[model samples]
Target: MALTSARGWQFRQPSVLPGFGLALGVTLLWLTLIVLIPLSGLAWRSSALGWQTFWSLATDPRTLHALWISFGCAFLAALVNVVFGVMLAWVLVRYRFPGRRVIDAMVDLPFALPTAVAGIALTTLYAPNGWIGAVLAPLGIKIAFTPAGIVVALIFVGLPFVVRTVQPIMEEIDREVEEAAATLGANRFQTVSRILLPDLLPAVLTGFALALARGVGEYGSVIFIAGNLPYVSEIAPLLIVIRLEEFNYPAATAIAALMLMVSFAMLLVINLIQAWSRRRYGYGA
Candidate 1:
């Protein structure tokens, strides 16, 4: 963009790129209509409930438990994704093996599969009588219908976000840097930690936030496997649905508002981390 002097004031010079103003206008118009409008309605409706009532509903034991399970499991799953997703991205980018393309495509199956179907399939696989669960049951392990089951479900849905986000960044990294590190007498671990990981940090953080956000709002894929025991495996999103189903609009709005605020805060933190990484490493910041 350039500035041009016009009538004692400076204005942005128009670019050859046509429709810049129109494009920006359309973008903002859609953002306001599709995103801001609904969010505004949600907040307004929640605010209609008196503060005391809203507080009571938000602080209810079941609601508290559900929120905890939702956030805690999502955080755990996101952390796991950050670790394994990076490794998977690394493998896909750096290695060539048989069935590589097939495995790469399989990573996106969750994206195409309906969440409800995913939930049922996962539940079937994790039920005590199911093959994997049957083997674990003999060892006194149980997953289905528990908090662990929620985490598992979340991990399944969230993995693709991390893998996809990090893979492109990994591919963009120059192999010459790794070779330089090796020539500098840095071992493999040192090379990865000092060079590649630093450069990938921003993308990793982005992927983690996306995964966490998705996990927080997950419902269908969790309900079947969660066993939905009031305070045990219930998620905040499910609680909101339950409230809505009972015609408790105010309560539902309040819970939805809470999740919205929390998710926003998380995204803000992720953005901050990305900025810091870019500044520190001179790549993504």
Candidate 2:
């Protein structure tokens, strides 16, 4: 009787909300309206540039430099965020102390603060004559108006994404797992690398991807601190704005399309890595 009942069972259980077809239709419609349509329109505009024009615009030295700065600084910032963000998440999850809640709340400040406001504040703190920069100036270390400044701004905006992404997953891990590893003669390093890391790898990759995406598209905060120097600190988004301001729509569209393609490719790679990590580590299993 059990075997017969099992064989008769449906693949999908009924839902209170709606059927699968209705849910999927709504999902696709929303995606089309919100995502697909805009992207398609951008591609259409870019296509009007002609392949040769598009390729030339994309390979222009100034455009290449801007794109390089944007992606490079973003990658560096995301890498920094992954290291510090993971450590911060671990601290928040594993320890308790005075001002713990306050510190935790501060992590979300970037999300709450307006981008322009954050830029102004960061500029105030890191400009040549500013408090932090003034101290570093004597030692000949410049933070503001440079690629390094862009990196700092990106890190500021992207850190929350990493911390928030990893925190919940860390919370879900049981303390007993670590204890068990220690009981089996595992040191702290071994427990973390062999036991905790495997489970955490997928989540870490997700956070890294989020941070990277945020960094790549960032504009306002970076602009205030980056000095907008051509071929030095000018970012792709800023370059697009420059093109638009100059009424060069074709050039603007070309840069935008290039950014979209590159961002999509990077995110796709990260997602593939996430999937592989899940399979290799049996994370969900």
Candidate 3:
């Protein structure tokens, strides 16, 4: 009888606060309301533009150029942020100096500043006759009202994301680890490449993904600097807005849907990379 009872026995644990069922229901309801519903509506709207029409819109020269400018400039900006952001995080985590706190706080100024205000400020600074632009004008370097201006705007806004994401992870690393590496006859380059980089890779990638996402979706901070010229400096988001203003809802929806799909695919790839890195490092294994 005891043997039979043991065979039939089962183990159970207490549910978390408010019970699993209620928590799941709330989570699903919130997601449906906020994310799923809106995205579904967008897809539905885009579908109204038949496949041929959608294809035409997507292949339009103006549309293609705008998309390219937006994604290309964003890619460049995120790459720049990754290099500078990692350096900044290292400095903040490893060193202590006068006014370090002030500098650290200033890194988040982009987050607090309004997007439109930031756009205006950047445009003013980079315009042909503006302060810094005046100095560069003689060198024949045009910044404002160009694609380079869009890149600059993106780099400004997306920087905080990379810095904040990497900072916490960097702080968690101990200096003693580097010291131990040095004691073992490892040169600075070897220690950094082998010991430090493996640990920081995942965090850096996360920051990069965040920065890229923000840059891709950015509109307000880009328009003023980009000059929004069709097939030249126009960004995808601005194109969408222009379509909407022209009462071309189908075209707008098609562009938005395409962006949504592309953004989702890029983020999914980044997440896969993060997962693979974690597994290779034996993290959470």
Q: Taking the tens digit of each residue's C-alpha lDDT, what string does model 2 give over 1-285?
A: 999998897857778866888788899999999999999999999998899999999999999999999999999999999999999999999899999999999999998898888888888999989999999999999999999999999999999999999999999998999999999999999998899877888898999999999999998788899999998999999999999999999999999999999999999999999898788867767
Question: Which scores better on TM-score, 1 or 2?
Answer: 1
How good is model 1 by TM-score?
0.93
Which is the better candidate, 1 or 3, if ranked by TM-score?
Answer: 1
Per-residue lDDT tens digits of candidate 3, residues 107-128?
Answer: 9999999999999999999999
Task: Supply candidate 3's per-residue lDDT for 54.
Answer: 94
Candidate 1 residues 75-143, lDDT tens each?
999999999988988899889999999989999998889999999999999999997789889999999
If ranked by lDDT, best first, what sequence of candidates would result? 2, 3, 1
Task: Estimate every model's Cα lDDT from 0 to 1.
Answer: 0.90, 0.93, 0.92
> Which model scores highest in TM-score?
1
RMSD of each: 3.3, 4.7, 4.5
Q: Which stretches of candidate 2 lie over 4 Å from their true place?
A: 1-18
